[model samples]
Target chain A: MSTPRTALVRLVAGREISVKLRDKGFLASTAVFIAIIVLAVVVPVMLEGDTPEYTVAATGHAGAVAEVAVELGGAEVPGLPAADITVIGLEDPTAGAGGDPVDEAFLRGADAVLSSDPDGTVVITAQENVPGDLEELIAAASSAVTAQDVAVEAGLSADQLAALTSPPQPRIDLLDPKPSLPVPPELVIVIFGFLFYFTVLTFGASIAQSVVEEKTSRVVEILVAAVPVRWLLAGKVLGNAAMALGQVVLIVGAGLVGAQAIGEGDIVAQVLGVSGWFLAFFVLGFLMLACLWAVAGSLASRIEELQSTTLYMQLAVMTPFFSAILIRDEGPARVALSYFPLTAPLMMPARVATGDAAAWEPWVAMVIVSATAVLLIGVGARLYSGSVLNTSTRTRLGGAWAAGGRA
Target chain B: MTDATLAVQGLTHDFGQRRALDDVSFEVRPGRLTGFVGANGAGKTTTMRAIVGVLRPDAGTVTFGGASMTLEVRRRIGYMPEERGLYPKMKVAEQLVYLARVLGVTKDDAQARAASLLEGLDLAERRDDLLHTLSLGNQQRVQVAAALIHEPDLLILDEPFSGLDPIAMDAMAERLRDRAAAGVPVLFSSHQLDLVERLCDDLVVIHHGRVVAAGDARALREQRAGRRYRVDVGGTDAWMPALAGMTVVGSGPEGTLVDLDESADPQALLAAAQAAGPVEHFARTVPSLAELFAEVVR
Candidate 1:
């Protein structure tokens, strides 16, 4: 009796997935992915890498404010939540007599330099526009120094000077501040981008390699005879995609568990939120690339040919990956990448994680990706069926398509 | 025309700018072992592939039981492709069961049959071993067992005996005979004419993508044999008188083997030979399948 197509596909899929379960490469990569995720949250907290560091160079009376500047910067420089500033005191008398303080400051590796002109007008030098916190810091430092000098010259003791004067600094507030995560948003994008990039490349390429293995080994002859070509294609894509998704879950689950363990409840919730969308957009997106990767596998008849055959798929996987992270903040580019089918998988969920996506935008991107996946599935099947039987080891896509027409 | 019979009629196929099979036609009747003979690239594999639907012919129909080939009908046929298409990474029994299930056997039965089939092929001890771990000859045995696991209705094996040792060959021959004895049509291809002569009940000869000769093996040999007689008379030239009505095609040892003229009669020749001396041996000659194959292909 003839086997039902679905039944045979299920059988093939079961074998594929089971085979991958035993694969050492797959298992090793899964462990690596989990470690990366867990480390992304853990390393920064342990290192206390959150505080921003700055350096300033100065000389003379204008440079004298370095002391007061250090005092205020130590006690929470207003706009910068946690910041540290170091002032380098230039002792060369010639530095102020005939040299440019800005040039000297920059040569000394300072972010900004303070110096007094012969006319005794205080000057600050910075690149482009000075950063806001540093400007506020410099201005307050200048005022407090001037006040200290005036009060101290009146013959009051240092204790009396301290009693009457404290550095009163400028404070400003914003109506909207981006919500922060335990891990930076950029790190979140790197994690998401990297997860999609690695899983798709690894899983998709494996799907193709399996196809070539069947062909080169010629076992596909028996398989193709027993079942329709489409079923073989379906079984492989579905089975490997399932493996890829399961590994994603394990890696992300480990991440969430580790996050919560470290008391990063926010990281857990944020990843959990984006991953729901990640998985939603991811399942179909991975399928499209999986189909393309399968087509790549079918094009080659030898294991040697697989490297060349899979090149385009690697590029396809890479472009969107770099795009999602590198151009995430570029408005039109991010929006375009979010809507583009190949990139939608990475872009949509990443945008949501970075809090750039509107509520309804991911929904639209998901629909587009789902549709493109359907289209790629059809094209992949055709290319796969056509090229798979060519014993020549490599054939043009059009040739395979035409050949499949006859089959 | 019965469902147990396999028929290939006017089959044609081409592999871009080269014709692989052309006007091919033949039949494998039930309860017969048909040997398909051809040189390398002589369309033997192509015809087998076309029969099993692995390759679509440019024109022709492969029918079983008087109906056109279908997936169900294909399932009923156990086809072993020429290239030995079994997975090297899979365990022997697991590979066999998997192949059988794809051919429509239930998993439990497939497993049972695989175990017994491995036992029969003397591979029972290697059942759990991966296919690549086996010797080439053993792998060949497993390849054959792969085709028989489902106990198919018809058997079409391509170069099935190419790599078997003599003992393995006999075991396989016995198994094929068992299938044929059960009234299944068995079609297989081989370049070994001696083996074919000893084993095949039917023969199909192909050369240059065309079917040159086909039918019951004995009948084909007889059909191609010429009128001839072997005679001996006291190991002497005394039967030279018989040469009047015949031409000596060969002469040695116990006789002169002669192809008779139209007017020559075997009885007349015998009488003529005895008139000269005591006739020691007189018998008509029949061609062996090997000779007939050479003659037909030549």
Candidate 2:
């Protein structure tokens, strides 16, 4: 025969899971969240621009300039992608300027058009929505060729002309070396911090709300009579934890697949490599806070009063989120938070992701969090048992403790 | 069916300095419906709570089938609190099955039992509906169904008949009788004395946190019966004034209710009434449960 306590716990957990899964609001919200993950992954791939390449059409005297311009434009710019410039010779020499309007096909094929007016002014016509960098590249090429022409006309030597046309390069040496802080890891850390904060807050409040609902409806009396109070608490924690873990996996999995499809797979891989640590911390952290949520819920007799009663729990969850974001770069603060169980779950994973903590720090934090969770479970169970059956008004924590002790 | 007897002995409890129950004791025999009648705040709820282990009494104990009420035995008993509670968001059938499963019933068995209970309560058609959607009367039936789903050895219901209509009351009373007939002791608290008088085989009357009266329903009435007699005669009321030890309390078209001293011979009074005219009726009136409750409580 099964132990009645275990059986009772399983029954309560099963009921919680089934009821929440059947809630239309929960289903709709989860669906919306999944859609967001998909979009976050796919939108970047759609927005990534291809290698920069430009085709130029030249006529008459501008052909020489165009030739030199194409060579220089094709060279890589300091901070921009290298441009590929192709000069298509016009048979009429003035075809680009006055002979006939360029056909739609040519306009579509060439990025820009170049021609010389009869008075000798060079004109460059670019396509609509040409990026600023591309326009700068074309201008630099044209100016270089023009400068070379003027130098040649003034009888300057080849060396002088080259010196005049080329821009100077500056060089410096740093006394101290700094590690490169890549944009992706920083972005990932912030995102993970928020994820931890919101997940804990939302689910924690949910646990509290569920408890208060049962209390207000007086269903808890029947429940307490049937099963031990601690077992009921465990069942609720387990049920919500299962749901929370499912949500985490869905989000992380979507993120990884999206990152991979967009060629940012390495960043996601690095994040996932440490996600095991994140998962461990999340479960421990959520369990620790979830216990308090159950206690907070038991204190309130009605749903309207639930919010005020659970405010401290909400604030506790938010403290870590804000601390992680505000003190992200403060090494000492991060180290201190990593040791504290309340903030450790949010901070430790981020520290590991950013390569800021020692290898053993996360393990230490995990141990501390797990121990704290056990302790809180005991305290929370007492509170739950003490106040769960009292439906008269708000139950004080101390009163509940006393009641629980008597029981 | 297990024959279970519930016994509460010297159960005393307090809320802070206020005494909720004082030396309360009662017995519910197997295969009997015991009505726990008490006025408001008379410790009925507290006594029931103690029996179910929801409240720890400062003194005394509740025993089931000759054993102290342990978790194992508590599981074998069903309790419905004064505040009827069921998950409003849960379907009627599912909620019943869940409660049964918590008590260690197999899932399939729980489901079958829930279905049967709903059918018996005339709620089979509404089984799939959420509890909050049902009328209060239907919900009361579902609450009753929840309490009975596990086929507990003892049934404890607090005010199970309060919000029920007459039809629902009849059904609930019949169900309780059926359970008792199966050898399960049923202890229920209610302020509805008429229904209690009609339905309960045994009555436990509580006043000021004490068991003032208990035992067979008819026996308690006969025990509490005073020396009051109702006499009907064909002729006048003049003879009533001449009676020495008998005081006329009430007179109606049917008869005159006389309060006789304990030393007064009722047979002599009957003869005198017959001599005056034709004796139509002469009998002592038995106290109602309500009258008994009022008398004991006062």
Top of the candidates by TM-score: 2
Off by over 4 Å in 1: A46-173, B237-239, B275-281
Model 2: per-residue lDDT, tens digit, B1-298?
Answer: 2546788999998888888899998899999999999999999999999998888899999998788987778888778988989999999998998888888888899999999999988999998999999999899889898889889889999999989988888888889999999899999999889999999999998988888998999998998788988889877654463587888888877788888897788987898888889888899999988999999889
lDDT tens digits, residue span B1-298, model 1: 3456777889998888999999999899999999999889999988988888888899998999887877877877788988888888889999999888877788999999999999999999999999999999999999989888889888999988999989989999999999999999999999888899999999999988999998888877777666888889785863555456788777777777878878878787888788767788888777886777677778
DockQ (model 2, Cα)? 0.60
Backbone clash numbers for all candidates listed: 2, 1
Give one digit per residue, the lDDT tens place, for model 2 in A1-407. Answer: 33567667777778778977997877787777778877877786676545556777777777777776666656665654456677776545354454444443264487667778887777776657655655676566667777877899999998888778665777767786444442355676677777777778777878888898888888888877767889999999888888888887888788788777778766576777778888888889999999899899999998988878898998989988888777778477789998898999978987887778779989899999999999999999998989888888999989999998877
lDDT of 2 at B110: 95
- Residue pairs that clash (backbone atoms under 3 angstroms), model 1: B2-B65, B3-B65
lDDT of 2 at A309: 88
Each prediction's whole-model lDDT (CA): 0.84, 0.83
lDDT of 1 at B43: 96
CAPRI level of candidate 1: medium
Model 2: CA > 4 A from native: A52-55, A60-78, A82-87, A93-109, A116-122, A127-130, A140-183, B1-3, B235-249, B259-265
**Winning model by lDDT:** 1
